[model samples]
Target: MLADMRDEVFDQDRACQALSHDRDRLVEAMDSGVADIDRLTFPDGPLTLLDLAVHVTMWDEINLGVVTLALRGRPHWSLDPRWETAEAGGALNVGGVRAGRGLTEELIRHRFHAVRQAHIDTIAEIPRSQWEQELPFAHSGSQPRTLGGLCHYVNTPEADPTRKLTYQHAAVHLGATSLSRAAPTGTG
Candidate 1:
Protein backbone atom coordinates (compact mmCIF):
# COMPACT_ATOMS: atom_id res chain seq x y z
CA MET A 1 0.00 0.00 0.00
CA LEU A 2 2.76 2.43 0.89
CA ALA A 3 4.68 1.55 -2.26
CA ASP A 4 1.64 2.17 -4.39
CA MET A 5 1.20 5.55 -2.76
CA ARG A 6 4.75 6.54 -3.65
CA ASP A 7 4.39 5.26 -7.18
CA GLU A 8 1.21 7.22 -7.63
CA VAL A 9 2.83 10.52 -6.70
CA PHE A 10 5.83 9.73 -8.86
CA ASP A 11 3.71 8.86 -11.86
CA GLN A 12 1.54 11.94 -11.53
CA ASP A 13 4.58 14.18 -11.15
CA ARG A 14 6.20 12.66 -14.21
CA ALA A 15 3.07 13.14 -16.23
CA CYS A 16 2.64 16.73 -15.08
CA GLN A 17 6.21 17.68 -15.92
CA ALA A 18 6.06 16.04 -19.33
CA LEU A 19 2.77 17.67 -20.15
CA SER A 20 4.06 21.10 -19.09
CA HIS A 21 7.08 20.78 -21.33
CA ASP A 22 4.95 19.50 -24.17
CA ARG A 23 2.62 22.46 -23.84
CA ASP A 24 5.58 24.83 -24.03
CA ARG A 25 6.87 23.19 -27.18
CA LEU A 26 3.40 23.21 -28.65
CA VAL A 27 3.03 26.93 -28.04
CA GLU A 28 6.44 27.57 -29.55
CA ALA A 29 5.51 25.60 -32.63
CA MET A 30 2.31 27.55 -32.92
CA ASP A 31 4.21 30.82 -32.77
CA SER A 32 6.34 29.78 -35.72
CA GLY A 33 3.85 27.65 -37.63
CA VAL A 34 0.92 30.01 -37.56
CA ALA A 35 2.83 32.59 -39.55
CA ASP A 36 2.85 30.22 -42.51
CA ILE A 37 -0.50 28.56 -41.97
CA ASP A 38 -1.92 29.75 -45.25
CA ARG A 39 0.85 28.02 -47.17
CA LEU A 40 0.92 24.73 -45.28
CA THR A 41 -1.19 21.73 -46.24
CA PHE A 42 -1.06 17.98 -45.73
CA PRO A 43 -0.70 16.11 -48.98
CA ASP A 44 -2.93 13.24 -47.86
CA GLY A 45 -5.53 15.60 -46.43
CA PRO A 46 -6.81 19.17 -46.25
CA LEU A 47 -5.24 20.15 -42.93
CA THR A 48 -3.58 23.51 -42.47
CA LEU A 49 -1.31 24.24 -39.52
CA LEU A 50 -4.25 25.78 -37.69
CA ASP A 51 -6.32 22.73 -38.45
CA LEU A 52 -3.63 20.55 -36.94
CA ALA A 53 -3.68 22.59 -33.73
CA VAL A 54 -7.40 22.18 -33.45
CA HIS A 55 -7.04 18.48 -34.08
CA VAL A 56 -4.44 18.19 -31.35
CA THR A 57 -6.60 19.95 -28.78
CA MET A 58 -9.68 18.17 -30.02
CA TRP A 59 -8.46 14.67 -29.43
CA ASP A 60 -6.48 15.54 -26.36
CA GLU A 61 -9.71 16.69 -24.76
CA ILE A 62 -11.39 13.41 -25.62
CA ASN A 63 -8.48 11.47 -24.17
CA LEU A 64 -8.87 13.51 -21.02
CA GLY A 65 -12.46 12.43 -20.80
CA VAL A 66 -11.51 8.82 -21.41
CA VAL A 67 -9.02 8.93 -18.57
CA THR A 68 -11.61 10.54 -16.33
CA LEU A 69 -14.17 7.86 -17.08
CA ALA A 70 -11.69 5.03 -16.77
CA LEU A 71 -10.63 6.18 -13.33
CA ARG A 72 -14.24 5.63 -12.30
CA GLY A 73 -14.38 2.27 -14.12
CA ARG A 74 -17.16 3.66 -16.29
CA PRO A 75 -14.99 4.13 -19.36
CA HIS A 76 -17.29 5.33 -22.03
CA TRP A 77 -16.87 8.32 -24.35
CA SER A 78 -19.84 10.25 -23.10
CA LEU A 79 -17.97 13.48 -23.78
CA ASP A 80 -18.48 16.62 -25.79
CA PRO A 81 -20.61 16.02 -28.84
CA ARG A 82 -17.83 17.39 -30.98
CA TRP A 83 -15.58 14.50 -29.94
CA GLU A 84 -18.22 12.00 -30.97
CA THR A 85 -18.30 13.65 -34.40
CA ALA A 86 -14.54 13.61 -34.62
CA GLU A 87 -14.50 9.90 -33.82
CA ALA A 88 -17.11 9.21 -36.45
CA GLY A 89 -15.20 10.97 -39.16
CA GLY A 90 -11.59 9.73 -38.60
CA ALA A 91 -8.38 11.26 -37.27
CA LEU A 92 -7.62 13.74 -39.99
CA ASN A 93 -11.04 15.24 -40.34
CA VAL A 94 -10.63 18.97 -39.83
CA GLY A 95 -14.34 19.51 -40.14
CA GLY A 96 -15.04 17.24 -37.21
CA VAL A 97 -12.59 19.13 -35.03
CA ARG A 98 -13.85 22.52 -36.08
CA ALA A 99 -17.43 21.57 -35.47
CA GLY A 100 -18.41 24.71 -37.39
CA ARG A 101 -16.58 27.23 -35.21
CA GLY A 102 -14.12 29.44 -37.01
CA LEU A 103 -10.69 28.84 -35.50
CA THR A 104 -8.61 31.93 -34.97
CA GLU A 105 -4.99 31.61 -33.95
CA GLU A 106 -5.77 33.13 -30.59
CA LEU A 107 -8.71 30.86 -29.90
CA ILE A 108 -6.82 27.76 -30.89
CA ARG A 109 -3.93 28.69 -28.66
CA HIS A 110 -6.25 29.38 -25.76
CA ARG A 111 -8.10 26.16 -26.40
CA PHE A 112 -4.80 24.30 -26.44
CA HIS A 113 -3.86 25.54 -23.00
CA ALA A 114 -7.33 25.03 -21.61
CA VAL A 115 -7.51 21.43 -22.77
CA ARG A 116 -4.05 20.66 -21.50
CA GLN A 117 -5.01 21.99 -18.10
CA ALA A 118 -8.15 19.89 -18.14
CA HIS A 119 -6.11 16.80 -18.91
CA ILE A 120 -3.52 17.58 -16.28
CA ASP A 121 -6.04 18.46 -13.59
CA THR A 122 -8.18 15.41 -14.20
CA ILE A 123 -5.26 12.99 -14.24
CA ALA A 124 -3.87 14.53 -11.09
CA GLU A 125 -7.04 13.75 -9.19
CA ILE A 126 -7.00 10.01 -9.89
CA PRO A 127 -5.84 7.61 -7.18
CA ARG A 128 -2.78 5.47 -7.88
CA SER A 129 -4.68 2.23 -8.37
CA GLN A 130 -6.84 3.81 -11.04
CA TRP A 131 -3.82 4.59 -13.15
CA GLU A 132 -3.32 0.90 -13.80
CA GLN A 133 -6.94 0.13 -14.58
CA GLU A 134 -7.46 -0.83 -18.21
CA LEU A 135 -9.74 1.44 -20.19
CA PRO A 136 -10.28 1.06 -23.92
CA PHE A 137 -11.22 3.97 -26.09
CA ALA A 138 -14.38 3.83 -28.17
CA HIS A 139 -12.56 1.73 -30.79
CA SER A 140 -9.42 0.18 -29.43
CA GLY A 141 -7.51 -2.99 -30.28
CA SER A 142 -7.37 -6.04 -28.03
CA GLN A 143 -4.50 -4.76 -25.95
CA PRO A 144 -5.73 -3.02 -22.82
CA ARG A 145 -4.77 0.59 -22.12
CA THR A 146 -4.69 2.46 -18.84
CA LEU A 147 -4.44 6.11 -17.79
CA GLY A 148 -0.70 5.73 -17.51
CA GLY A 149 -0.64 4.04 -20.88
CA LEU A 150 -2.53 6.90 -22.47
CA CYS A 151 -0.15 9.44 -20.97
CA HIS A 152 2.77 7.37 -22.21
CA TYR A 153 1.09 7.01 -25.57
CA VAL A 154 0.86 10.78 -25.96
CA ASN A 155 4.24 11.59 -24.45
CA THR A 156 6.23 8.73 -25.97
CA PRO A 157 6.68 8.03 -29.66
CA GLU A 158 6.10 4.96 -31.83
CA ALA A 159 5.63 4.27 -35.54
CA ASP A 160 1.87 3.77 -35.56
CA PRO A 161 -0.74 6.45 -34.75
CA THR A 162 1.64 8.60 -36.82
CA ARG A 163 0.04 11.76 -35.45
CA LYS A 164 0.35 11.97 -31.70
CA LEU A 165 -1.60 14.21 -29.32
CA THR A 166 0.95 16.96 -28.69
CA TYR A 167 4.45 17.90 -27.55
CA GLN A 168 6.99 15.44 -28.89
CA HIS A 169 4.41 13.83 -31.13
CA ALA A 170 2.51 16.66 -32.76
CA ALA A 171 4.55 19.84 -32.28
CA VAL A 172 8.00 18.28 -32.44
CA HIS A 173 7.81 14.97 -34.30
CA LEU A 174 5.02 15.52 -36.79
CA GLY A 175 6.03 19.11 -37.42
CA ALA A 176 9.61 17.99 -37.99
CA THR A 177 8.70 15.65 -40.85
CA SER A 178 5.71 17.49 -42.17
CA LEU A 179 7.41 20.89 -42.31
CA SER A 180 9.70 19.62 -45.03
CA ARG A 181 7.06 17.49 -46.71
CA ALA A 182 4.53 20.30 -46.71
CA ALA A 183 6.96 22.89 -48.01
CA PRO A 184 6.83 23.59 -51.73
CA THR A 185 10.05 22.76 -53.57
CA GLY A 186 11.05 25.81 -55.61
CA THR A 187 13.52 28.65 -55.52
CA GLY A 188 12.15 31.52 -53.49
Candidate 2:
Protein backbone atom coordinates (compact mmCIF):
# COMPACT_ATOMS: atom_id res chain seq x y z
CA MET A 1 0.00 0.00 0.00
CA LEU A 2 2.81 2.38 0.73
CA ALA A 3 4.37 1.60 -2.60
CA ASP A 4 1.04 2.25 -4.29
CA MET A 5 0.75 5.52 -2.45
CA ARG A 6 4.24 6.48 -3.50
CA ASP A 7 3.40 5.66 -7.07
CA GLU A 8 0.34 7.82 -6.85
CA VAL A 9 2.41 10.63 -5.47
CA PHE A 10 4.86 10.30 -8.33
CA ASP A 11 1.99 10.43 -10.79
CA GLN A 12 0.61 13.47 -9.05
CA ASP A 13 3.99 15.17 -9.22
CA ARG A 14 4.21 14.50 -12.91
CA ALA A 15 0.74 15.86 -13.39
CA CYS A 16 1.57 18.99 -11.42
CA GLN A 17 4.67 19.51 -13.52
CA ALA A 18 2.63 19.20 -16.67
CA LEU A 19 0.07 21.66 -15.40
CA SER A 20 2.77 24.11 -14.52
CA HIS A 21 4.29 23.78 -17.95
CA ASP A 22 0.92 24.22 -19.62
CA ARG A 23 0.17 27.28 -17.50
CA ASP A 24 3.54 28.75 -18.37
CA ARG A 25 2.82 28.24 -22.03
CA LEU A 26 -0.55 29.86 -21.64
CA VAL A 27 0.91 32.88 -19.90
CA GLU A 28 3.57 33.17 -22.55
CA ALA A 29 1.08 32.87 -25.35
CA MET A 30 -1.26 35.39 -23.82
CA ASP A 31 1.51 37.79 -23.11
CA SER A 32 2.67 37.52 -26.67
CA GLY A 33 -0.85 38.42 -27.82
CA VAL A 34 -0.28 36.06 -30.73
CA ALA A 35 -3.76 34.58 -30.35
CA ASP A 36 -5.54 37.84 -29.47
CA ILE A 37 -6.57 37.57 -25.85
CA ASP A 38 -9.21 40.19 -26.47
CA ARG A 39 -11.20 37.59 -28.36
CA LEU A 40 -10.97 34.85 -25.77
CA THR A 41 -14.23 33.15 -24.88
CA PHE A 42 -15.31 31.27 -21.79
CA PRO A 43 -18.06 28.73 -21.28
CA ASP A 44 -20.43 31.38 -20.10
CA GLY A 45 -19.78 34.08 -22.67
CA PRO A 46 -17.26 36.20 -24.46
CA LEU A 47 -14.57 37.73 -22.28
CA THR A 48 -12.70 40.90 -22.91
CA LEU A 49 -8.96 40.50 -22.76
CA LEU A 50 -9.01 42.09 -19.33
CA ASP A 51 -11.76 39.75 -18.16
CA LEU A 52 -9.85 36.73 -19.35
CA ALA A 53 -6.75 37.97 -17.61
CA VAL A 54 -8.62 38.46 -14.38
CA HIS A 55 -10.19 35.00 -14.59
CA VAL A 56 -6.85 33.35 -15.23
CA THR A 57 -5.31 35.20 -12.35
CA MET A 58 -8.16 34.30 -10.05
CA TRP A 59 -8.06 30.66 -11.05
CA ASP A 60 -4.37 30.45 -10.35
CA GLU A 61 -4.70 32.02 -6.94
CA ILE A 62 -7.64 29.87 -5.91
CA ASN A 63 -6.05 26.62 -7.05
CA LEU A 64 -2.75 27.42 -5.41
CA GLY A 65 -4.43 28.35 -2.15
CA VAL A 66 -6.28 25.06 -2.17
CA VAL A 67 -3.08 23.10 -2.81
CA THR A 68 -1.26 25.01 -0.10
CA LEU A 69 -3.96 24.26 2.43
CA ALA A 70 -3.97 20.62 1.43
CA LEU A 71 -0.25 20.41 2.01
CA ARG A 72 -0.67 21.96 5.44
CA GLY A 73 -3.56 19.67 6.38
CA ARG A 74 -5.96 22.57 6.70
CA PRO A 75 -9.44 23.12 5.37
CA HIS A 76 -9.48 24.66 1.94
CA TRP A 77 -11.42 27.87 1.39
CA SER A 78 -15.09 27.95 0.61
CA LEU A 79 -16.15 28.11 -3.02
CA ASP A 80 -19.35 29.96 -2.42
CA PRO A 81 -19.59 32.62 -5.07
CA ARG A 82 -20.45 35.35 -2.61
CA TRP A 83 -17.74 34.29 -0.21
CA GLU A 84 -15.20 33.73 -2.95
CA THR A 85 -16.09 36.96 -4.61
CA ALA A 86 -15.55 38.76 -1.34
CA GLU A 87 -12.33 36.91 -0.72
CA ALA A 88 -11.15 37.52 -4.26
CA GLY A 89 -11.96 41.17 -4.01
CA GLY A 90 -9.85 41.38 -0.90
CA ALA A 91 -6.99 39.43 -2.41
CA LEU A 92 -7.05 40.90 -5.90
CA ASN A 93 -8.50 44.26 -4.88
CA VAL A 94 -8.64 45.59 -8.43
CA GLY A 95 -11.93 46.37 -10.06
CA GLY A 96 -12.56 46.09 -13.77
CA VAL A 97 -12.86 49.80 -14.23
CA ARG A 98 -9.70 50.40 -12.27
CA ALA A 99 -7.93 47.57 -14.04
CA GLY A 100 -9.01 48.91 -17.39
CA ARG A 101 -7.69 52.37 -16.67
CA GLY A 102 -4.02 51.48 -16.74
CA LEU A 103 -4.00 48.03 -18.31
CA THR A 104 -1.39 47.14 -20.85
CA GLU A 105 -0.44 43.85 -22.44
CA GLU A 106 2.94 43.91 -20.80
CA LEU A 107 1.49 44.49 -17.35
CA ILE A 108 -1.01 41.69 -17.69
CA ARG A 109 1.73 39.39 -18.89
CA HIS A 110 3.94 40.24 -15.98
CA ARG A 111 1.16 39.58 -13.47
CA PHE A 112 0.38 36.20 -14.97
CA HIS A 113 4.04 35.21 -14.99
CA ALA A 114 4.34 36.08 -11.34
CA VAL A 115 1.19 34.19 -10.47
CA ARG A 116 2.28 31.15 -12.45
CA GLN A 117 5.70 31.14 -10.84
CA ALA A 118 4.18 31.24 -7.38
CA HIS A 119 2.02 28.23 -8.18
CA ILE A 120 5.00 26.33 -9.56
CA ASP A 121 6.99 27.09 -6.44
CA THR A 122 4.17 25.93 -4.18
CA ILE A 123 3.79 22.66 -6.01
CA ALA A 124 7.53 22.03 -5.90
CA GLU A 125 7.84 22.65 -2.17
CA ILE A 126 5.07 20.33 -1.04
CA PRO A 127 6.06 16.77 -0.10
CA ARG A 128 4.69 13.71 -1.85
CA SER A 129 3.33 12.14 1.33
CA GLN A 130 0.75 14.90 1.56
CA TRP A 131 -0.78 14.06 -1.78
CA GLU A 132 -3.01 11.40 -0.28
CA GLN A 133 -4.07 13.46 2.70
CA GLU A 134 -7.52 14.95 2.56
CA LEU A 135 -7.85 18.70 2.63
CA PRO A 136 -10.93 20.84 2.55
CA PHE A 137 -11.83 22.46 -0.76
CA ALA A 138 -15.07 23.77 -2.06
CA HIS A 139 -16.77 23.60 -5.41
CA SER A 140 -19.93 24.85 -3.77
CA GLY A 141 -18.81 24.80 -0.16
CA SER A 142 -15.98 23.35 1.89
CA GLN A 143 -15.29 19.74 0.89
CA PRO A 144 -12.40 17.33 1.09
CA ARG A 145 -10.04 16.25 -1.64
CA THR A 146 -6.61 14.74 -1.82
CA LEU A 147 -3.83 16.71 -3.43
CA GLY A 148 -3.57 14.01 -6.08
CA GLY A 149 -7.27 14.25 -6.75
CA LEU A 150 -7.10 18.03 -7.25
CA CYS A 151 -4.21 17.64 -9.64
CA HIS A 152 -6.10 15.00 -11.56
CA TYR A 153 -9.25 17.11 -11.64
CA VAL A 154 -7.41 19.98 -13.27
CA ASN A 155 -5.76 17.94 -16.03
CA THR A 156 -7.94 14.90 -16.59
CA PRO A 157 -8.89 14.02 -20.15
CA GLU A 158 -12.50 14.14 -19.04
CA ALA A 159 -12.10 17.76 -17.98
CA ASP A 160 -10.64 18.67 -21.34
CA PRO A 161 -13.57 17.17 -23.17
CA THR A 162 -16.03 18.91 -20.93
CA ARG A 163 -14.34 22.28 -21.31
CA LYS A 164 -14.28 21.95 -25.08
CA LEU A 165 -18.00 21.28 -25.13
CA THR A 166 -18.62 24.16 -22.79
CA TYR A 167 -16.62 26.51 -24.96
CA GLN A 168 -18.59 25.42 -28.00
CA HIS A 169 -21.80 26.12 -26.18
CA ALA A 170 -20.57 29.54 -25.21
CA ALA A 171 -19.65 30.34 -28.77
CA VAL A 172 -23.06 29.29 -29.97
CA HIS A 173 -24.81 31.31 -27.32
CA LEU A 174 -22.79 34.39 -28.11
CA GLY A 175 -23.37 34.12 -31.86
CA ALA A 176 -19.69 33.62 -32.31
CA THR A 177 -19.90 30.56 -34.48
CA SER A 178 -16.73 31.61 -36.26
CA LEU A 179 -14.80 31.00 -33.07
CA SER A 180 -16.27 27.55 -32.68
CA ARG A 181 -15.73 26.81 -36.33
CA ALA A 182 -12.08 27.69 -36.04
CA ALA A 183 -11.46 25.43 -33.08
CA PRO A 184 -9.31 22.45 -33.92
CA THR A 185 -10.87 19.05 -33.78
CA GLY A 186 -10.03 17.09 -30.62
CA THR A 187 -8.88 20.26 -28.94
CA GLY A 188 -9.90 18.84 -25.59
Candidate 3:
Protein backbone atom coordinates (compact mmCIF):
# COMPACT_ATOMS: atom_id res chain seq x y z
CA MET A 1 0.00 0.00 0.00
CA LEU A 2 2.81 2.43 0.83
CA ALA A 3 4.65 1.60 -2.39
CA ASP A 4 1.51 2.22 -4.38
CA MET A 5 1.16 5.64 -2.80
CA ARG A 6 4.73 6.53 -3.74
CA ASP A 7 4.17 5.46 -7.33
CA GLU A 8 0.97 7.44 -7.51
CA VAL A 9 2.66 10.55 -6.15
CA PHE A 10 5.51 10.18 -8.63
CA ASP A 11 3.09 9.75 -11.51
CA GLN A 12 1.02 12.70 -10.39
CA ASP A 13 4.07 14.94 -10.04
CA ARG A 14 5.37 13.98 -13.46
CA ALA A 15 1.98 14.57 -15.07
CA CYS A 16 1.42 17.94 -13.44
CA GLN A 17 4.91 19.12 -14.37
CA ALA A 18 4.53 17.98 -17.96
CA LEU A 19 1.16 19.65 -18.30
CA SER A 20 2.57 22.91 -16.93
CA HIS A 21 5.53 22.80 -19.30
CA ASP A 22 3.35 21.98 -22.29
CA ARG A 23 0.97 24.78 -21.44
CA ASP A 24 3.74 27.36 -21.13
CA ARG A 25 5.32 26.31 -24.40
CA LEU A 26 2.03 26.50 -26.26
CA VAL A 27 1.16 29.82 -24.70
CA GLU A 28 4.55 31.26 -25.60
CA ALA A 29 3.97 30.16 -29.18
CA MET A 30 0.61 31.85 -29.38
CA ASP A 31 1.97 35.04 -27.84
CA SER A 32 5.07 35.19 -30.04
CA GLY A 33 3.15 36.32 -33.12
CA VAL A 34 5.83 34.81 -35.35
CA ALA A 35 3.90 31.90 -36.77
CA ASP A 36 0.87 32.50 -38.88
CA ILE A 37 -1.62 31.15 -36.41
CA ASP A 38 -4.15 30.47 -39.15
CA ARG A 39 -1.73 29.02 -41.69
CA LEU A 40 -2.30 25.31 -42.27
CA THR A 41 0.70 23.33 -41.05
CA PHE A 42 -0.18 20.06 -42.74
CA PRO A 43 -1.34 19.14 -46.21
CA ASP A 44 -3.16 16.05 -44.97
CA GLY A 45 -5.41 18.06 -42.70
CA PRO A 46 -6.71 21.55 -41.95
CA LEU A 47 -4.72 21.91 -38.76
CA THR A 48 -3.36 25.37 -38.07
CA LEU A 49 -1.35 26.44 -35.05
CA LEU A 50 -4.48 27.96 -33.58
CA ASP A 51 -6.38 24.80 -34.37
CA LEU A 52 -3.78 22.79 -32.52
CA ALA A 53 -4.32 24.88 -29.39
CA VAL A 54 -8.02 24.37 -29.71
CA HIS A 55 -7.58 20.65 -30.25
CA VAL A 56 -5.57 20.27 -27.07
CA THR A 57 -8.03 22.43 -25.19
CA MET A 58 -10.88 20.26 -26.34
CA TRP A 59 -9.20 17.08 -25.15
CA ASP A 60 -8.34 18.69 -21.82
CA GLU A 61 -11.98 19.62 -21.34
CA ILE A 62 -13.05 16.06 -22.13
CA ASN A 63 -10.48 14.58 -19.79
CA LEU A 64 -11.58 16.90 -17.01
CA GLY A 65 -15.04 15.35 -17.23
CA VAL A 66 -13.61 11.86 -17.39
CA VAL A 67 -11.39 12.43 -14.38
CA THR A 68 -14.18 14.03 -12.37
CA LEU A 69 -16.48 11.11 -13.11
CA ALA A 70 -13.83 8.59 -12.17
CA LEU A 71 -13.07 10.43 -8.93
CA ARG A 72 -16.70 10.20 -7.98
CA GLY A 73 -16.70 6.47 -8.80
CA ARG A 74 -19.38 7.10 -11.37
CA PRO A 75 -19.68 4.82 -14.37
CA HIS A 76 -18.43 6.66 -17.42
CA TRP A 77 -21.37 8.27 -19.11
CA SER A 78 -20.02 7.51 -22.58
CA LEU A 79 -20.17 3.77 -22.10
CA ASP A 80 -23.66 3.75 -23.51
CA PRO A 81 -25.10 1.69 -26.37
CA ARG A 82 -24.70 4.68 -28.67
CA TRP A 83 -20.94 4.26 -28.47
CA GLU A 84 -21.34 1.62 -31.14
CA THR A 85 -21.97 4.30 -33.74
CA ALA A 86 -19.37 6.76 -32.55
CA GLU A 87 -16.42 7.36 -34.85
CA ALA A 88 -13.84 6.68 -32.19
CA GLY A 89 -12.73 10.33 -31.65
CA GLY A 90 -12.45 11.17 -35.34
CA ALA A 91 -15.75 12.93 -35.03
CA LEU A 92 -14.70 14.55 -31.78
CA ASN A 93 -11.48 15.78 -33.34
CA VAL A 94 -13.22 17.17 -36.37
CA GLY A 95 -15.88 18.85 -34.30
CA GLY A 96 -13.27 20.30 -31.97
CA VAL A 97 -11.45 21.92 -34.85
CA ARG A 98 -14.70 23.15 -36.33
CA ALA A 99 -15.83 24.61 -33.03
CA GLY A 100 -12.55 26.46 -32.75
CA ARG A 101 -12.74 27.81 -36.28
CA GLY A 102 -13.36 31.54 -36.65
CA LEU A 103 -12.88 32.11 -32.93
CA THR A 104 -10.51 34.84 -31.88
CA GLU A 105 -7.01 33.66 -31.16
CA GLU A 106 -7.32 35.17 -27.71
CA LEU A 107 -10.28 32.94 -26.86
CA ILE A 108 -8.47 29.78 -27.83
CA ARG A 109 -5.39 30.79 -25.89
CA HIS A 110 -7.50 31.62 -22.86
CA ARG A 111 -9.17 28.23 -22.95
CA PHE A 112 -5.85 26.51 -23.52
CA HIS A 113 -4.50 27.93 -20.27
CA ALA A 114 -7.71 27.57 -18.25
CA VAL A 115 -8.52 24.00 -19.23
CA ARG A 116 -4.93 22.86 -18.74
CA GLN A 117 -4.76 24.32 -15.25
CA ALA A 118 -8.03 22.68 -14.36
CA HIS A 119 -6.73 19.34 -15.59
CA ILE A 120 -3.54 19.70 -13.61
CA ASP A 121 -5.44 20.65 -10.46
CA THR A 122 -7.80 17.74 -10.84
CA ILE A 123 -4.96 15.29 -11.37
CA ALA A 124 -3.17 16.59 -8.32
CA GLU A 125 -6.17 15.97 -6.06
CA ILE A 126 -7.09 12.49 -7.30
CA PRO A 127 -6.64 9.77 -4.66
CA ARG A 128 -3.90 7.22 -5.17
CA SER A 129 -6.39 4.40 -5.75
CA GLN A 130 -8.38 6.48 -8.19
CA TRP A 131 -5.33 6.93 -10.37
CA GLU A 132 -5.12 3.16 -10.86
CA GLN A 133 -8.82 2.50 -11.29
CA GLU A 134 -9.49 1.53 -14.89
CA LEU A 135 -11.60 4.10 -16.66
CA PRO A 136 -14.61 2.78 -18.57
CA PHE A 137 -13.70 4.91 -21.58
CA ALA A 138 -10.82 2.64 -22.54
CA HIS A 139 -12.42 0.84 -25.48
CA SER A 140 -10.03 1.88 -28.23
CA GLY A 141 -6.72 0.08 -28.47
CA SER A 142 -4.90 3.40 -28.04
CA GLN A 143 -6.91 4.48 -25.04
CA PRO A 144 -5.22 4.28 -21.67
CA ARG A 145 -6.92 2.06 -19.05
CA THR A 146 -6.33 4.24 -15.99
CA LEU A 147 -6.49 7.91 -15.11
CA GLY A 148 -2.72 7.95 -14.63
CA GLY A 149 -2.28 6.53 -18.13
CA LEU A 150 -4.51 9.19 -19.63
CA CYS A 151 -2.55 11.93 -17.85
CA HIS A 152 0.66 10.59 -19.33
CA TYR A 153 -0.78 10.06 -22.78
CA VAL A 154 -1.92 13.64 -23.35
CA ASN A 155 1.31 15.25 -22.15
CA THR A 156 3.88 13.09 -23.93
CA PRO A 157 5.37 13.68 -27.38
CA GLU A 158 4.17 10.39 -28.81
CA ALA A 159 0.61 11.59 -28.28
CA ASP A 160 1.17 14.30 -30.87
CA PRO A 161 4.30 14.00 -33.00
CA THR A 162 3.46 17.30 -34.62
CA ARG A 163 3.96 18.92 -31.23
CA LYS A 164 7.09 20.40 -32.72
CA LEU A 165 5.02 23.00 -34.50
CA THR A 166 3.78 24.32 -31.17
CA TYR A 167 6.82 23.63 -29.02
CA GLN A 168 10.17 23.89 -30.80
CA HIS A 169 9.16 25.81 -33.88
CA ALA A 170 7.06 28.41 -32.19
CA ALA A 171 8.40 28.53 -28.64
CA VAL A 172 12.15 27.99 -29.12
CA HIS A 173 12.46 28.78 -32.83
CA LEU A 174 14.28 25.49 -33.31
CA GLY A 175 13.91 22.87 -36.00
CA ALA A 176 11.35 20.10 -35.52
CA THR A 177 14.06 17.45 -35.60
CA SER A 178 15.52 18.86 -32.40
CA LEU A 179 12.45 17.92 -30.38
CA SER A 180 12.22 14.42 -31.84
CA ARG A 181 15.35 13.40 -29.96
CA ALA A 182 14.32 15.10 -26.74
CA ALA A 183 13.01 12.92 -23.95
CA PRO A 184 10.08 13.70 -21.72
CA THR A 185 11.27 15.64 -18.70
CA GLY A 186 10.13 15.39 -15.10
CA THR A 187 10.78 19.06 -14.45
CA GLY A 188 8.29 21.82 -15.09
Candidate achieving the largest TM-score: 3
Worst 10 residues of 2 by lDDT: 1-10
The parts of candidate 3 lying over 4 Å away from their true place are 1-10, 34-46, 75-86, 133-146, 153-188
Q: What value of lDDT does candidate 3 attain over all alpha carbons?
A: 0.56
Candidate 1 weakest ten by summed lDDT: 1-10
Residue 91 lDDT in candidate 2: 43
For each candidate in the order shown, give its overall lDDT on alpha carbons. Answer: 0.52, 0.47, 0.56
TM-score, every prediction: 0.59, 0.54, 0.63
**For residues 9-56, could you state the per-residue lDDT of candidate 1 as single tens digits?**
126655665566555655666677642333233335555555656766
What are the RMSD figures for all models against the true structure?
A: 10.3, 9.3, 7.4
Q: lDDT order of candidates, best first?
A: 3, 1, 2
What digit string (tens of lDDT, one per residue) describes model 2 on residues 36-110?
A: 433233443445544555555655666677667666666455334564554454444345424533678677767
Name the best candidate (by lDDT): 3
